[model samples]
Target: MSLGSSKELAENKIILLYMIDKVNMPVSNHHITKLVLENKFMNYFILQQFLNELCDSGFLELSENGGKSFYSITPNGKKTLEYFVNLIPFGIKSIIDNTIPEIRSDIKKESLISADYTPKSENEYIVSCKLKEDNFTLIDLCITVGTKSDARTICENWKNNPQQIYSEIIASLTRKRDKTNRDKDKDED
Candidate 1:
């Protein structure tokens, strides 16, 4: 590649790192693809390559979350970003600064409640639901269904009402136990 393309590549790499670094979340490949395309930063192919290259080179870390590839900046990536962030265009930096908050909110929402399905066989599917707050995981549930549609519906329900579901489960589990403990404590008092 020519000098211009090379520089653009480095800048684009930094853009990916900067975005991931800014959000400080396990950003999905889809989100990265969308951001790069929407910002006119680069093409999808280059974005994909950058993700792989960055992770491979220890500039980023990759993990599977919610059955999708999630990328986060490694410590090395942060240092690199800190060092060469000036090379990224001010327009690009401005756009990233403006866009990251929305991404942060979206990722936070995603982390709060999540669902995914895996096929067990020809007819059975298992849907896993997760409800989390900050660093604490409130619930992690798996339901098995005979059909894919059933699994999908369960996932939707879990995503829609994880908080309520968690509350109900907690209430049910505590109801009898709490009542018994309260009766014993009243007698003692």
Candidate 2:
């Protein structure tokens, strides 16, 4: 599984970039391994080598969490990814674009994709996606809603009442369910 040459690395770079962009998320080495295994025609060692080369080139960044390495796109890597994505044939891109999202959504619904949001304080919550290593955390916060005044109020209220934030999400879901039930009844009538 020696990458041994630049041409091999370049080929791998193309495939890896395509896979990453297609998924639209940071991917772990395990995920890449699985993809390579499924393809059968691809050389796993070559893929690994390409990944290393990309990291060296600053096109990708690797974070170790737990014991595994997770690879994320850097700004330069994103530019390279876009270049490869555009090279995809239109028909092939159409099929992949249509199918990949459905697959990713199903995986997320199954909780295969790690996601968690924790309330830190009123008007603030810690939102993170689990990476491969415990120390490597992708954390962000969301505040405000709507536009102009409505957005300002949402942010102000959220800051004042943290617990209410969670409750609001629940309330929204409940309202949606009740509305759906009423619609079903009306349809039946």
Candidate 3:
């Protein structure tokens, strides 16, 4: 690459690290793509290349969950950005700082709820639902269904109503049952 192109590439890489660091959490690949495309920082293809390169260079960590990829800046990435953040233009950095809060909130909210399905056999599918906070998983549930449609429905319900479903599940599991007549009589005797 020419010097100009190399400089641009470095800036773009720094921008990705800066964004992930500012978000300060594991953000889904989809969200990162959306943020970059929405900001017109670079084209989709280029952004993907940068993400791959960052991961390869140990500047970012990648995790897979529910078939989605999430990215977080590595400590090395933060150190690098701290050293070369000046490569990014002032206005661009300002935009990033301003844009991060809303994106962070959205990422945090979305990361809490997850649902996915995988085929178990010709006629069976397993649906997985999860609720997570920070680094902890609050709930991880899986159910098998006879059909794909059923699995999809279950996944949707879990995603849409995880809180209510969690509450109901906990209540049912912990509910106190009245003593049986025989047990009560035996105790009295």
Model 1 alpha-carbon drift over 4 Å, by segment: 1-4, 65-67, 118-125, 144-146, 164-189
Which has the higher TM-score value, candidate number 1 or candidate number 2? Answer: 1
**lDDT tens per residue, model 3, 1-189:** 233487899999999999999998888888888889988999888889889999999999999875678999999999999999999999889988998899988877777888899998989998889999889998899889999999989988887898999999989889886679659989899
Q: Candidate 1 lDDT (Cα, whole model)? A: 0.87
Expressed as tens digits, the lDDT of each residue in 1-189 for candidate 2 is 454566545555766666666776656777667665665525777677778888899988898764557777788987876666655446544655565575565434323224344465565554433222233422223443333444445445544444455456657767745688889999999
- Badly placed stretches (over 4 Å) of model 3 are 1-4, 63-68, 133-138, 171-189
Candidates in order, TM-scores: namely: 0.72, 0.45, 0.72
Which residue runs does candidate 2 get wrong by more than 4 Å? Answer: 1-9, 84-99, 102-189
Q: Residue 23 in model 2: shift from native, Å?
A: 1.6
The CA lDDT at 128 in model 1 is: 86
Clashing pairs in 1: none
Note the residue pairs that clash in candidate 2.
65-132, 65-133, 66-133, 122-162, 123-158, 123-159
